[model samples]
Target: MKKRWYDYLWIASALYLILGFFNILFAWLGLLCFFLPLIISITTGSKAYCNRYCGRGQLFALLGGRFGLSRQHDIPRWMKSKWFRCGFLLFFLVMFGQMLVNTALVFSGARDLGQAVTLLWTFKLPWHWAYHGGVSPWIAQFAFGFYSVMLTSTVLGLVTMALFKPRSWCVYCPMGTMTQLICRAEYRPERKKTAC
Candidate 1:
């Protein structure tokens, strides 16, 4: 399949990530990438996001194919294991939840607003330097935290692409895993496992 001009969703995603990094609230917009696709996959039992609109995945393709970085190796069985995939998804979800709560606490006045340099972005250097050390109103902190969460996902996606097949990351992606869970396989009585 040849790449199409409209498939450049990753560029928009990158810009939004940068915005979320500086503005925070924009992180919600970034999440639509996952939530929307998860919703569609639930009804269709297909990874529609990967097929059509995953910006990160598209970036991986560009890196691997356009830059000739892909080894094109078969993914190891360990990575493809359901147990490993689900475990990773669970871990990813927990981290995501924790970040959200942290952001909420800061925004809700339940805690002191943490300064810039969340998670690992620039080791605490404030973003959007145009605003005097990247400091903005308190609301900006919430956005920074959200962008940190996104950075985690972005790093994982990049690493997964580098280490395995381009689409291998999809197998362990939290949103994809969630959709696969909701969209269960077709019923087949003969395929049911019998208690040993």
Candidate 2:
């Protein structure tokens, strides 16, 4: 079968899911798998994942294409300004803090710390049951909420891309932001040609 551009999203998502499972089961191999997509995306472009291989992206493309909402528009510069960048950075920092705190709580025997955090965020899923039932309730809730946030963010990204010409989600994506910082240090833009 000729692979469509959208098929890549599904492939990537599947890879991510498998990697997550392996990370939980095999650990070391999972760590390597985690970086695989990141390396591929950086070497190629955000399209390596968002445009091609993300399951969420594939779903979005299908729905948008069917509904005639697939049109892309130019993202305004102001929307990508310093304020937005700072805000996104702050958001990432908060997420990191939450993750650190959750880990600390799990290790320190303050078991319910993680679940309280999830409940505060309105995520009521039973994480332990979803997993192997060995992890504490707090850790389980944290994992559930973490995955929920990831899924929510992906949907939001799709909506942003469908409405914006240049893939708006890339602008505020934490991973993309980090990769771009690395790429900028190594990449130089080609000079424009001018007619004599």
Candidate 3:
């Protein structure tokens, strides 16, 4: 098969992680990853982003498929269950909500900027070296929190890739789930009103 331009997105995905590690502000770029999928799904009523344009998915395929890092085991039935996927989506949204709340607090001067990246929503890894003090507290706080979310999800994808198939993380990815939902809603049949 001929490789398309998007096939090289894995390099861009890897670079984003590397750049964000060295410059915390680069984390803001993650918003594109978060929004582009939904926009594509809504406009096209399809999951083209999740199926084709997802850089992280491509990265996992490169690592687990080309590099042979995956065990190639089937993902557990529970992990593929709709209930589990929805639950995970709910949990991910709650974490995102918390991140937004923290950013709002910093913006309001109610809380100081947090300089650490919270991994798995528990471990606070110091990331002060990546952050400079020139930016607004809220902006920097958002960067740190958003970076944590992106890094944590990437770690989960890597782990699942190693344990199961390379694209196993896609089964329950929150963005994938959201985009699926958006596509479904976009194409859902509507009841036509009867004229009086």
Write the residue-wise lDDT of candidate 3 on 85-168 in tens digits. Answer: 999999999999999999999999999998999998999999999997798999999999999999999999999999999999
Residue runs of model 3 more than 4 Å from their true location after superposition: 188-196
Which pairs clash inside model 1? 24-143, 117-124
Candidate 2: where are CA atoms >4 Å away?
A: 1-6, 11-34, 37-59, 66-76, 113-132, 135-142, 158-167, 189-196
- Alpha-carbon RMSD, each predicted model: 5.4, 5.7, 4.7
Cα shift from native, residue 13, model 1 (Å):
2.2
Model 2 Cα shift for residue 132 (angstroms): 4.8
For candidate 2, write residues 7-93 as lDDT tens digits: 765465545545433233222232332364478657764435434444644545555566556566777787678677657757865
Clashes of each: 2, 6, 0
Q: Candidate 1 residues 1-196, lDDT tens each? A: 8978659997987787677555556765766776787778766767667678888777778887788666777788887788987998888777677767876776677777665545533355555542233443455655666677677677776776777776666767777777777666632346767789
Worst 10 residues of 2 by lDDT: 22-31
lDDT of each: 0.68, 0.54, 0.93
Better of 2 and 3 by lDDT: 3
In model 2, the clashing pairs are: 8-52, 8-53, 9-52, 9-53, 9-54, 73-165
Return the TM-score for candidate 2, rounded to 2 decimals.
0.59
Ranking by TM-score: 3, 1, 2
Q: Give the Cα error of residue 130 in candidate 1, in Å.
A: 7.9
- lDDT score, candidate 1, position 99: 64
